[model samples]
Target: MRVEQGFQPTPYTEGNPFTTDPVLPNLLKRLLPRDVHEEVYGDLERFGLKVLTTLHDLTSKTSEPRVVQYDQWGRRIDDLQTSEGWRGLKAQMQEEGVIGIPFERKYGEFSRVYGFMKQFIAIGDSDVISCPFAMTDGTSRVLELVGSPAVKRDIFPRLTSRDPSLAFTAGQWMTERPGGSDVSQTETIARPVSNASSPYGPVYRIDGFKWFSSATDSDIAVALARTGPPESGSRGLSLFLIPLRRPLIRPVDAPRPPALTNNIKIHRLKNKFGTKILPTAELSLEGAEGYLLGEVNQGVKFITPVLNITRIHSALTSVGSIRKCLAIATAYSSVRAISGGRQLLKDNVLHVAELARAHLTYRALTHFVFGVVLLLGKTECKVATDDEVLRLRLLTPAVKAFAADKASGVMEECMTMLGGQGYMEESRIGTVLKDAMVEKIWEGTTTVLSLDMVRAAAKPGVLHASASTISNMHQWANTIVSSCPADLVHRLAERLATLRICVTEVISAYTNPSTPLLSRPTLALFAYTTSALYLLEHAIWAHESGEATANTDIEVFRRWIDEGGLLPALQDVRRVKTAGADRTKMDAEIVYGNTSTTQVVDDLPISARL
Candidate 1:
């Protein structure tokens, strides 16, 4: 319904969608700085293209559906050689060195490096790409090559420079175990192997097993083991450099097999639902020789920096999953038709509207997330104080958990929108759902992360640092509402104020030790709402500053609000059960669920599932 012939309008013209100057885009240039956040996001974005190309290649080559059956993964989740179908996939995996099947030269000589982008929905690491850590260890090096960088200085000259000729090769590792969230549990025993004729001088022997061993076939590995007893709860633990192959080297007169020389063995593969791309494995160390990283009993500390980085990257990965859901749901809504051959999209105006709404919401949410991280990365927070570290830790769990938890529902709703088609793999909604489901379990569960937030929430003499952030967002939301009935806006604002007070009171009451057991879930929900509002408020403000939501996005949101953004906005206010008004407005959003408002409000719309 855009105007082809109309009188030129002034600022905020209803007809001209691009009425506002894109000041925000320019503002982003000045305000934000060059940093890792931008770089990493860029990398992820590039990889996403790589993934899309990979998927496209897959689709083109498909004579039949790219089927993935559960049984193909062995009794253990990591095994993908169950039958002809799996073996076929395996050959394709090795041939492509990527996930998308019937593989072709998508990124020639690159082999579709981003094939596992959709694995975000996995419930566990046992998907196609079961072991991201295995391949990257969150680093671009195999653990073995990485573990003893200093010791391997002899061959450093050759490995020093990137190949001027070909694609950069990388490896993965799978060494995580069930019991170790913070540290490498010292279950495996390490002994300095003596009287052994091997290239590595004074090789140490390792015996025990590693669970969650991902990227087991990587170039190198860093396996942790306890040299002694329990007093070394974590103190006696040491990490070793287990390499896949010994780099060509001159013979050295020494006893004990030093580098990877057919000693360490992969025990089995884990079988699980989702993420069939990454490989998570299990391994047994039987007298495998090795070197150490950092210091003994210091494996846990050595891994912290790397672990945090991985968590952040994983957070982005989840964001990618969320994006996948949006794309799949949005596309499906357009094509799906209903009772009278009319598209479910246009036939049911609500669905079409809500899909548009949800797409914007997800984009904005992730954009804020990406923007924040980018801003933070531009600054030097490396040598931060204990307080700063605590803040980072506190925020870390929250971002990972919140993004992931919401993604689950978001993807599911997208899946639901497709009806029968979404249930199958042909549409990609299923993949979106699967990927979103896994985001919750990884890094930290929602509850686990929320607890961390609660623990870090109130500092001495402070109730809410984020409250001001929320207040600004409230002001902006109020702006949107102002365009509605003036009396209605006032009344609604009053109710919102009252609900905030009540919610705060309830939360304070809930925090008291005297609170009963029955209050837990209710309190948790309330706390979640409070926390989410704070986060959401920050998210919104990040854009309002003119750094984002300008240009195309602004028009998108404007169109959405003109339709029914207020309904969803009020719905959130109502979640705290503020006064309800304009049931008709609410119904349009509820029944249709197609606008950006719906996404920020609910994330997933019914059409996404179809």
Candidate 2:
């Protein structure tokens, strides 16, 4: 047999995603007791190995889920057939209490941090099964928030159950053809079902279509449906908990049905560009029975909890994916020979720099993501200060958007480092990149989330709290620099000052008429500035604790600041207006592509000129 010449695969590392690197665990040790860290780290290590197997199955393409819309008898069944690998993942997640940790209260206030960290570790190897887990976690949290006692009593245990057979995953069915992120345009309608009742409360018959239903195999869903007139917009909507399948177990003697008994009809499965193993469906709900959750017409407010949770999940997934890709690239670099027959790891200076930057990106994003997670933990435990809650609210979109934006770039760069081998489907690098692309699009696109950050910032007291937090970070940096190597201190100090100035400028720009284009840059500035501050804190921690890798951590921070890592592209107002005008014209020209900007500009008042 002719073997492929000059190819060597990197051996898999067998251990914990967290414990192997003491950075994350060490960072947590600053807050938790040593014993607590050890216990949490050990638990993650054991389960991480199993999760690694799931990753292997996913990368090897052995767990692609398929939709079977009809039975062999040509009757509608609308069943989802997933692979054994997928089943194993679901079972392991449930058994491991992956979705239940925060609610379990075993770890008390730190539980949310623990839960989210476990998710962050598991996501790299989770085959994106974390999708359903996110929804399940969010759904459970929403139920708790809305005070749906009966629903909680009946569904909460199953949502958090350790038994796979009993555990139920949930879907967030909010997207529709008319509204993707603007949930105010929701078209799904909920009509009162006369004399009907559910575990939650009064029953409603749901009717309409959901355009993008993720985790379609879930047992139940939390959805938004209009209970008021169509003109009521988001205010008219009501939240509902709809079981995909009736809860009653069918008797063995019961007659077999030709089609699924539930009213949810799977119209088609989306042929997605990535996440091929998870089934996502476009569904029609024709008279599907549901129980109203929360007060009528407060669906948006009720579902806010779920959105926050899912957004955090999305951020974690981005970081996790980037981490895994970087790991693969690092491993391959050690073994693969590059240009001039040199070991890629040893002889390539630029390659080494790229790798170093990737590592830097990973370290920085870890802090940013986990900072939010820690805040989330505090808020959930009702121990968070007002400032912390405000920070969490402001940072959620920033972290999610920023991580996703950087994560895709990280994967692409890592894949490029793999060269020819990276393009191969079997290399799994492409798959990682493909899957990561959706992250920025889902949860919310960067532009959408940037605008969200602006809205969040505009809220009363948010900007002031944010300013205080950044100031506190600056003080922390100053303290760290007081003791660290002298060569780096001045530069770090300068960068910190730059960060403060940039933040202040952006804040001012938010209200300035001439700087109406500050939305995107301001959000980017917020994310990058905060992330740098977090990186500085971690660096200080590593140094103060005398970790062996403290110098390496310090250098990453040094490079980040020296390389203009904290500086954002701040355009002058004149240029911004010019660009705005150009864009407005271009947008007018393009019904499809390019049209006439003259018509648009001609109609505008002088004061309203682009």
Candidate 3:
């Protein structure tokens, strides 16, 4: 018997990301010094094509890491055996400086821009190895803030090494069973050791269970343990660096240290719906050696640096994944045959429209996330002004939450464009969707992040500063739009005005005690306004800078606005308080109804009732 094959999509071409997105190089050209941009761009191009593409292929073939608790001789040895493909890819990442780029600072002020652009591309092919990379980057940032001289001398170099043999990854162990994001309820206990033997100073013994440890096979971890009495909450907790294995340093010339237990026991791995390529495990630390970081009882404040870094990672993961999805969907639509003997790309107006919108979304999110990345780079380089610093603090949570949420919706639409095939495991659409969902939940949930935005806006001068920045961006956009088609420019101008009004209402709602219910909606409105401003700016730049596809870029901006991209919330300042009060009343009524009635009942034996 003979079998017939069906239509299949040609695989997406993997090459230099700089070439893939002309806008990226153009953005870099404007942001970085010419000499620095050229060098950084060249190196990243080579790494992206030669190293990242190969690793992406390898990652697709690798299985999840398996944990072996005992040796064949019945000796206790907790070993995490990962696939050759995973190991090979990890080695390549080290050699390519995927995790080292930002910390190394070889490219100067624009180092982070170059580094983040590389990360943005690498993540698409990263097989969720980016999970560990995110935590590792966060750990590095934390150490930079508080690590002792010895810790910095011995660990920072190894962490930032481009040589695989000497490099190490770090994990973040923060969550516990009883307390999810509420670190105030942390139950982990740390007892001081007067004369402990360790490279890091002020050693402590940790005893607690971590509910979620994403990178179980990592060399070291940053954890939180209560150094004060049980009632101390977040204030009583302290941050500690614990080596997963003793003698954490890996010297290139010497043989790797012998398998030494660190009293960190892996209870079980999480059977997650997505990111199966990364191993997330539950761990129990009993008498585990850890070195206290920073002053005792000041862990919460210090941990913010790490969280800030990881949150950016979460945003990158979101934007990168959606970009990949758009690429796949667009390519598949171009080739797949449909009605009237026409390809889906050419014949289907609805499909074409979907692709156009997805493209617009991808562009907007790219700018939003990258904008944050640039701010972070400036902050790190000590070149940022006070206003920029304040904007960075305000925008971080907003961008992370908004981008992650928007990516999920965009990916879903892209999946729908692929029809039934997108649902299959072999297509990997479902995998990306699941992974994107995790990004929304991790780092911080939408609700939690919205509250953070409220807090930031409430800070003195922050709201006004953000408003002024948006106004300046709008003026610049209007100047660039002057040369474009009149109707399109007018529409954009209208949207920009709505954005301004919405921002004012959002700030007002947040500040007023009676309008607590407006917090989430206000944050959403703020995000929409910010995203629209970014898209407008990108369109303006494309037109003025004579980018390769200026006309198409302008059209994307038009479509984005035409499709109701920047529509403000219906609840403005006038209605926010009323809506909030109504919501609270309804909620209370549900819990305890206004019509109260009571009835008494006599208990009966179970057998008699039956």
Residue 131 displacement in candidate 2 (angstroms): 0.5
| Full-model lDDT, candidate 2 | 0.76
Cα lDDT listed for each candidate: 0.44, 0.76, 0.76
Residues forming the 10-long window of minimal summed lDDT in candidate 1: 12-21
**Candidate structures ordered by TM-score, highest first:** 3, 2, 1
Model 1, total clashes? 59
Clashing pairs in 3: none
What's model 3's lDDT at 11?
Answer: 49
List clash counts for every candidate, in order. 59, 1, 0
TM-score of 2: 0.88
Clashes of 3: 0
lDDT of 3 by residue, 327-439 (tens): 66876776677774556554688778777777777887887788888889889878887766777888899889988888888898888887888787766677888877899
Candidate 1's residue-wise lDDT over 1-610, tens digit each?
4685654322111111011112222323333344522432344444334344443344333221121223354422222223333223323334333322102223332211222322322212122333343234233322323444444443322222222121111232324454544343456777776666333333677777777654443445555677657566667675555554444243434322322354555555566465544444566666766665556666555554445545554565666565655566655555556665544564587787666566554544454344334322322223343343444544455556656655666667777776766688856556546645666676556655555445554442122325333322233334433343443334345434443553454435324423122232333333233333333333234345454443444344343233323234334433533324555466778888758765665656668745
Question: For residues 297-357, could you state the per-residue lDDT of candidate 2 as single tens digits?
Answer: 9998999999998999989899988877877777777776666565656357888888887
Sorted on lDDT, best first, the list reads: 2, 3, 1
**Deviation in angstroms for 501 in model 3?**
1.7
